[model samples]
Target: MSRLELSPNFSDPDAFYAALTEAHRERSEADSERINARLILLLANHIGEQQVLEEALSIAAADSEQPR
Candidate 1:
């Protein structure tokens, strides 16, 4: 199985972030949450790699305040 790549993989991360924020603009909190869930499912499906997804989940679950 391939290892999860932690480094910057997107060609335009900031642009993507801007677009994502734009998508949530003016949305209600519930609507924004639904949008996020849908996006997550779509991306996870596109990834289509069990191991990589699990690793991503583990990393995401880590507390941001604590050292890695």
Candidate 2:
């Protein structure tokens, strides 16, 4: 077999995140948004900021229960 190479198109972090969020929103399968929420939390932890992360978690939790 010949070697194959794959590359991600995300040139910037912000653009990558935006694309991720959009894709997450577009998913129709069950639990897709929940997966996205986990991803968001992971990214937030990576970025640091206990206060901001807490605030973001609060907002997300509040919105998760509402109609989309």
The model with the greatest TM-score is 1
Question: Model-by-model lDDT, in order?
Answer: 0.92, 0.69
- Candidate 1: tens digits of C-alpha lDDT, residues 31-52: 9999999999999998899999
Candidate 2 TM-score over all chains jointly: 0.39
**Residue range with the least summed lDDT across 10 consecutive positions in model 2:** 1-10
- Candidate 2, residues 1-68: lDDT per residue as tens digits? 22212245456979878877777786776668678679877887685777766666677688899997
- Candidate 1: where is the Cα deviation over 4 Å? 64-68
Could you give me the TM-score of model 1 versus the true structure?
0.87
